[model samples]
Target chain A: MPPAHPPVDTADVFALLERGRALSTPVLRAAVGRLAPPMDTVAAYHFGWIDAEGRPADGDGGKAVRPALSLLSAEAAGSAPETGVPGAVAVELVHNFSLLHDDLMDGDEQRRHRDTVWKVHGPAQAILVGDALFALANEVLLEIGTVEAGRAARRLTTASRKLIDGQAQDISFEHRERVTVEECLEMEGNKTGALLACAVSIGAVLGGADDRTADILESYGHHLGLAFQAVDDLLGIWGDPEATGKQTWSDLRQRKKSLPVVAALAAGGPASEQLAELLAADAKSNDFDSFSEEEFATRAALIDEAGGREWTSQEARRQHTVAIEALSRVDMPEHVRAQLTALADFVVVRKR
Target chain B: MPPAHPPVDTADVFALLERGRALSTPVLRAAVGRLAPPMDTVAAYHFGWIDAEGRPADGDGGKAVRPALSLLSAEAAGSAPETGVPGAVAVELVHNFSLLHDDLMDGDEQRRHRDTVWKVHGPAQAILVGDALFALANEVLLEIGTVEAGRAARRLTTASRKLIDGQAQDISFEHRERVTVEECLEMEGNKTGALLACAVSIGAVLGGADDRTADILESYGHHLGLAFQAVDDLLGIWGDPEATGKQTWSDLRQRKKSLPVVAALAAGGPASEQLAELLAADAKSNDFDSFSEEEFATRAALIDEAGGREWTSQEARRQHTVAIEALSRVDMPEHVRAQLTALADFVVVRKR
Candidate 1:
C-alpha cells in the first residue's frame, strides 16, 4: 500500500555498483585468464572485454547487480567491500556460467547485442568453456586458503545446484501445456533466488557476520531475486527492443512460457481462454514468422486483460516490500541499509 | 625392459576393484540421489543401475579402475580403502561428468550398452545433469570438512580443468587434417592422464603420503593412463563387437583420428599416404555406410602396414613398464606394491 521506508537514491546505488565492478573486474579477469587459450579468449569475449577477433572492445558485461549486492552485503556486515571481492567474483562467474549454458540450451544467439558463445565458438567449445568457468569459480574460492574458503565453496555449490535444478525445470516448463503460479514461483526461486541469496550470504559470511545476519541477508536476496525475475518477465513482453537490446516480442514469438504468460494462463477467465486459443493457434500453424505485429499486440492485450500484467506488477512490489523487511531484520549502518534498499527498489523497477 | 617386478595376480586386483566398487558405489548413489529428480533419473539410467524405463537392470557401471587405484594408493600409504572412498567417489563423478557431456558434444547415441544421457534425456537435460554432477563432485569433497578437503578440492579442480582442456583439444583435432604424435600424446595426457593422476594423488594425499610418495604414485598413474589409452585405441580398430559393444572398425568408419591413426598419418610412408588417401576419399564420398566391408578391412590393413599397430602395441608395453617402475620407486608393503603393479598390468592388458 504505502512505503514502509523512505525511497532510496537510485543514483547512489548505481555508483556503488560501479565502484563494485571497478574493484572486482580485474580480479575476475585474472581468475578467468588462468584458463587455457580459446577458453580464455571466449570468456573474454563473453565478458565484453574483447571482440570475437580478440581485439579490445567496449561492451557492457552486465549490470553487475549480483556483485554489487555482494559488496553491499559485506559493507552492511561491517567490513570493507574488498573483503567480499572473492565472493563477488565467484557469484559473477556462476552467473556467467549459467548464462553461457542457458544461451546454448535456449538457442539464444544474441547476448548484450553480440553473438553468444555457442553462436561464435560452436556448442562444444561453449559447453567446455562454461564448465571451465564453473571450475574456476570453485578453484578461486579454494585458493583463497582461509578458513572461510570451505564454507564459501559449500554455499556456492549448493546455490549452483539449485540454479541447475531451476534451469531444468524451466526447460521442462516450455514443453508443458500449463504450469501453476506456485510452480513458476518455485522454479524462479531456485533458478534466480538461490544465486542471489548465495551472493548475499557469502558476503556476510566472508565479512564475519554471524549466522543470523547471514540468514537475514539471504532472505533479503531471495525476495529481491524474485522481484528481479518478475520485472524481467514483464520487460520480455512489453519493453522496447531498443531498451532491452532484444528483438521485439521475442519471447512471445518463440512461445516462451515466461512467468507472466504462465500466470495469465493460470488465471482462468475468458481472457485466459482467448490467450490460450491464440497460443494454440500459433502452435498449430508452426510458423512463428506468420504471427504479425497485430497478433503480438492482441496477445499482449489479452495477457493484460487476463490480469497477468497487474498480477506481476503487484507481485514485484510485494516481493520488494518483503525484501526490505528482511533487510530491516539486521541492524546495520544506516547508509549501508539505505544502499540495500535502493538495490531492492532497483530490482523491482528497472526498465531494462 | 626386463621385468623389475614379478607379474601381479590379476584375480587379486579384480577382487580389490570389486571391493572398492561395492564400498564406493553406495556413496556415489547417495551423493547422486541428492540431485533433484529427472536429473537423478537420468543419472541413474546413465550409471546403468536402471533401464530407460527405470526398471532395475544388471548393468556393470564400469570397471571401477580409477576407484580401485585410489583405494590401493590409500592402502599403500598405510590407510584403509574406506579412507579413500571420498576420493574414489569424486573421481567417479568427474569421470561420468565427462562421459555425459562428451556424448552430447560428440553426438554419441550409445554408451555402456544403452542410450547416452543426452540421447535419452535430450541435450538440455544432459548438459544440466552433467553440470549438477560436476558441482556434486566438488560438494562431496568439501563436505568431507577436514583440513584435507580444500586440498582435495583444489586437486580435483585442477584435474577437471585439464580434463576439459583435453576434451577441447580432442574436439579441435577432429577438425584438423593432421595431428602430430606428440600433440596427440599431449592431448591424451590431459584428457585421460590428468584424472588418473589425480585419482592416485588424491588417495595418497588423503592417506597421508609424503610428497615423494604421492609424486611416484602420480607418475605411476600417468604412464598407466597412457598405456590404457593406447590399448583402447588398439581396441577401437580391431576389437570384436561382441566384447567391445561397438561396431566393427567403428573408429575408422567414423574417420576418427585416434592415436594410432594419427601416428600412422605421421609416418609419411606409402601406407600412410594410402591411409590418408582412403580417408580423403571417404570424406569426399560423405557416406560412411557406402564403404564396403572389404574397404574397411583394407583401411585396417593399411594402418597395420604403416606400423600404427606395432607402434601402439609397443607404446602400450613401454608405458606399462614405466608405470611399474614408478610404483617400484615408492617403497610400500610388498602385497600393496604387488596390487598396484597388478592394476597397472591389468590396465595395459585388458581386452575390453
Candidate 2:
C-alpha cells in the first residue's frame, strides 16, 4: 500500500512565512515600544529576536505555522493574503501568549532549547508579559478597522476562552484514574482544535469569503488540528529524542494523561494493569533515570498490544480524510486547495 | 473655605451595586462549571462568596466600587440605572481578574482579611482562575447582544493592557533611584485611570449615549480616578487602619514612590538626603517599621514646606473642575447631570 499524501509545495509555505513576517513585524515592533519598557526584554524574547540579556540573539524562532495557515486559508477562499495579515499575526500572537503562560503553568524551564520566559524573568513579569501580548492581540484586531473586523474580534475572543478551557481540562485529567477517549477528544477540541478553526475562520472572514466558504475552511482547520495532535501523541513516545528534541518518554514521566496513555488505560487488561503500576511508581519516584530501558521496552510492547500507536495513526488519517472532505465542500481555487490538503497530510504523517 | 462636596445618595449607589451584582454573578456561575472542577473552589473564593474549601464564607467582600460607578454614570447620563448593569458587571469582572493577578504579582497573601487565591490554591491554579475570569468578562460583553455592546469589550481589552503596562512600570520603578512625577502620573494613568475611564465610558456606551457623551463620562472617570488615588496616597500615611482596613503607614514602609514621595524628592533640599537614605534602607526588614515612621513625619513636613501636598490637592480640585466641566459640555437632563457631578465630588473628597 502506498502512503496517502497530497501535493505540498514547501516553497509556497516558505514564501508565505517570509511575506507574512514582513507585513506583520512592523505592527509588533511599533507595539513593543509602546509596551511597558520593563517587559520589552521578555516580549523580544517571545518574538525570538533576543535572549534574556538586552543583546539580540536569533532573528526568528517560531514555526509561524498557525499564521501561515491563516494567511493561506484566506488566499484559498478568494481574498488577497495581505488583507488578512493583521488577523494572521493576531492569531499567532494569541498562540504565543498562551505558550508563555502554559510554560509557567506546566513548569517547563526550557522552550526552543533556551530558558523559558518565566524562568528568566520570574512568574510576575512573565504573567504580565503574557497579558500584554493578549492585549496586543486584541489591539491588532481593532487595527482591522472595519465592521467585519469587530465580528472577527468577537470570534477570536471566543476561541481564546476555548483554548484556556482545554488547558484547564488537560490539567484536571492529571489526577483522574479514568478518562474516556471521547472526553479526551473534547479536551483537545478546546485546547488544539479551537485555535486552528479560528485561524481559518478569521482568515476567511478577513479575506471576504462568504459564510459558506468560511465554514468549510473552519471544518478543515478543525480536523487538521485533531490530526496534528494525534500524530503529536504518537511521536511523544515513539519518535527519536534527537529528531523530536523532546526528553525520552517525558510525557510518561510527567504522567501527562496524554491521548495514547488514556487510550492504553481504557483498553484494560494485564498489560494495562502493569502500565498503571509503573505510572504510580514513577509518580512517587524522584529519580526518573533509574527506570530501566528493559522496563521501557516492556511498556512499549504493552502499548502496542493495546493498539495505542495503531489507533492514533488510524485516527490521524481519518481526520485528514474529513479535512479533505471539508476542502471539497468549498469552492476553493484548485491550486491553493491542493497545497493546503498536502500540508494537512504532511502534518499527520510526518515522523517528527 | 466650605468644602464643595458632592451630595452622597448612598441609597441610589447601593441600589446600583445590587443591580450590577445581579447581572455579573450569573455569568461567573455559568462559566465556573467549565473550569477544572477541583480548581473551582479557588475560583469561588476569589469571588468572595466561598472559602478555599468551597464552603460559604463571609458576605460579598470588596465594595464593588467600580461597578457602582459604572451604573451610576449611566444613570447620571440620563439613561435608566439598569441600562448599564451588563456593562457594569463586565467591567467588574475585568477588575477582579486584574486584582487576582496583581495580588499574585505583589506577593500579597491577604485580601479582605482572608487568604489570597494564590495562597490557598497555588500559583498555577490561581493563574488559570484569573484567566478564566478574563475570558468570562469577554463572554459577558458578547452576551450583551448588541454590536455597540462589544465596544465595552474593546475598551476593556485596551484598559487591561494599559493596567498591565502601568504595573510593569511600577515594578521597574522599584529598581530605579529616582522617578519623575510625570512618569508616575503616566504610569498611574494606565494602571489606575484607564480602567475607571473604561468603567465610565462603558456606562455611556451602554446607555446608547453619543461619542461626545461617552468622552465626557470618560473624562469624569479619569479625574475621579486621579483624585481618588491622591486621597488614597494621603490615607496611606495618616488614615487609621481601623477605619481603612489597610496596614497603617504600609506604603511608607514599602518605600513606594507615590505622588507625594516623588513631589518631595523633586523639591531638592537639605531634607532630601535624609529622605533618600530612609528610602534606601532595606524594604523587607523589621527596621522598616521604625525608620519609616520617623522619615514619614519628616517627609510630610517637607512635603508641606515644598507645597507638595498643596499642589496635589490643587491638582485634585482642578481635575474635579474638569470633570464637572465635561459634564456641562454634554447635553443631559439637569437632575441626572447634577447626580453625576455629585458622584464626581464624592470620589475626590471621600473620607474613608
Candidate 3:
C-alpha cells in the first residue's frame, strides 16, 4: 500500500534553513544574552548580530545546518520541532564556540567577510567568550528538567570532547610531513563528524527516542559530516574565488593538509612524488609569500593529476550514499526523511 | 541538649584534605582517562600524575579543598560520602581546567613547583586539555542519570560561566590604570567564589537536598572563597618566596590589580598617592626587569602604610565570619558543619 503521505521530492534546502533559523534563533539569542558584559558583546559580534562597536549589524551568521538537523530529528522522532529547540540551541552554541576558538588558534583574521572576534577584540576575549559559550550549551541542555534532557546533555558533552580531540589532531597534522588518509579521516570524524552526529541524535533523544533509533540517526549524520568535509575541502582548493570569497588556490597557499592533498600523497604516483617534494620544500621555506600564483597553481595541478580531486569526489558520493542508507533504517515520517536526505545532498555538493 | 554526635572542636585541615584526596583521586583519574591521547598525556602532566617526559611522578597536586567540600556536603545532606564522588571529581576537573587556561592566559611559567602545561607541552595543548577537562566535567555529572544530576549539572555549568566571566573581567582589569574596590570584589567573587559555591553545594543537590539548603551552603562557599582569595593576595606580596614557590612580590611583579592594591588606591592617603605614582611609572616602563627588590619593597611598604594590608586582613575575617554564619541556617550534622567551619578558618589563615 502507498504511504498516507508520499515523500516530498528533495526538500527546498533554503526554506529548510530559514525554518531552522526561525525556530531556533529566539532560543539561541536568549541563551547568548545570558553571557556577561564584554564577553556578551564579543559573542554577539561573532554571531553577526552586532558590530565591533556594539551597534546592531545584520551580518552573516552561519547557515544553521546543525540546528536544521536537530529540529528535523525531532520530527523524525514523531515529536514537534519545538521539542528540539534546546538541542538545536546547544549545538549551535557549541559550533560557534569551536569557530571562535579555532579562528584564534589558526590566526585567522577574517570570517564571514568581517574581522573575527579575536582580531576585533583580542585573543583573551576570544578564549574567554568561547569558554563562556561552551558552558552555556550545557546550561541550556540540563536546564530542560527531564531525564531525556540529561541523556541528551551527556551525548552532547561526549561529542564535544571528541570534537576537541579532533581539533588537537588537526593542529598536530599541520607540523607533520605526512598524514595517512585513514588518520585524516579519523581526525575529521572526531573534529566534524562527532558534533554533527550528536546534533542529529540529541534532539531525538530529547524527544524520547530509543537508543537504537538515535544510534542509526547518528550514523547518518556522521557520514553526512564526512561528505560535508569532503565538499569543503574541494571548495578550499578549486572553487571560484568569487563564489568562495577566497583567493585562487587558497588551501595550496596556506599549505593545508586537507583530504585531497593527503589522498594525493597516499596515491603514490609520479605526480604525487613531485607534489610531495614541492610541498616539503615549500614547508621548509620561511617566506611562503615569496611564491607567485604559478607556484600555487602548479601544486594544485599536481594534486589533481595525482587523482586527489577525483578520489575526494568519489568519497563524497560514497559517504552521501552511506548516510542515505542509514536514514532508511529509521521509521521516520516519509517527508521528514526526505528533508534529512536533501540536507545531506546539499552538504555533499555545496560550493561554500 | 547536646546532639548525639558532638560537633568536633575543629577539623585537622590537612587530614581533611588527605581524606578528600583519597576519596576523589581515583574517580578523577578515571574521568581524565577517557580523554584521547596527547590530550590525556597533557592533562595527566598538568595534574602532576606524570612528569613532562610521561614518567610517573609523585608531585604536589593541590589542596583538594573543593573535593573535601563536595564529600562533606553529601554527608551534610544525610547521604553517604560516596554519593558525592562524581561531584567531587567534577569540581576537581573544573578547578584544574581553570588553572590550565589561566596559566596560559597570564603567562605563568610554573605551578606546584613544576613547569606549567603550556611551558612543557605548548599553548595549544594547554587550551585543548583544559577544554577537554571542562567537557569531561559535564559528562561526569550528566552520566549519573539522576534527576538530581540534571539539577546539579545546571548549577555547575552556570557557575562555570560565571567563572569565565570573572576571568574576562580580571584580564580587562590588567590594562586599566585604576580599578575600584567594588569592581575588584565583584570580579573575585565571580572568578573564585562562583566555582567554590558550586563545589560546596553541588553534592547536596546531587544527594537530593532542596534548593534552600543548597543555597545556604552556596553562600557559605562564596564567602569562604573571598576569604581564601584575600589570604592569597596577602601571601602574594608578603609571604616568603620559598613558602609560596613564587618570586617576592609575585603579584606586584606581574602588575596584578588585586584586592589589596585596589583597596589601597581607594583609601585616599599620602602613601596611597605615592604608591599609585610608583605603580603608574612601573606600568609605563618597558623594562620591569630593571626594578630591584628595593623598588618592589618600597611599593609594598607604601601600600601597607596606606592601610591596604590591614583592610584586607579585616575583610578576610569578616568574610570568614559570614561564611560560618551561613552554616547556621542549614540543618546538617554538627560535625560536618564544624569541619566546613574549620576549613574556612584554615583558608583564611593558611601560610601558603
TM-score of chain B of each: 0.95, 0.86, 0.96
Write candidate 2's Cα lDDT for B1-352 as tens digits.
1145545676665565566566556654666655556556677788777876677876456666677677766776678867776677667767877888887987776666577888888887777777777776777776555756766667778888888888888778767778998987787777778888888888777777777777777887777777777766766666576655566665665566777778777877766656666566554346654664666676666656665566667667776787778777777678767656666666665556
Model 3 chain A: worst 10 consecutive residues (lDDT sum): A1-10
Candidate 1, after superposition: displacement of residue B340 in Å? 1.3
Instruction: Evaluate residue B205 in candidate 2 and report its C-alpha lDDT on the 0 to 100 scale.
Output: 79
> Which parts of model 3 have CA positions greater than 4 angstroms off?
A1-11, B1-11
Residue pairs in candidate 3 whose N, alpha carbon or C atoms collide under 3 angstroms: none
Tell me the tens digit of each residue's lDDT in model 1 across B126-156: 8899999999999888887776767777788
Better of 2 and 3 by lDDT: 3
Off by over 4 Å in 1: A1-7, A280-285, B1-8, B208-212, B280-285
Ranking by DockQ: 3, 1, 2
Docking quality category of candidate 1 according to DockQ thresholds: medium
Q: How much is the lDDT of residue B204 in candidate 3?
A: 94
lDDT of 1 by residue, A106-147 (tens): 998888878899998899888999999998998888888766
Best by DockQ: 3
Pairs in clash, predicted candidate 1: none
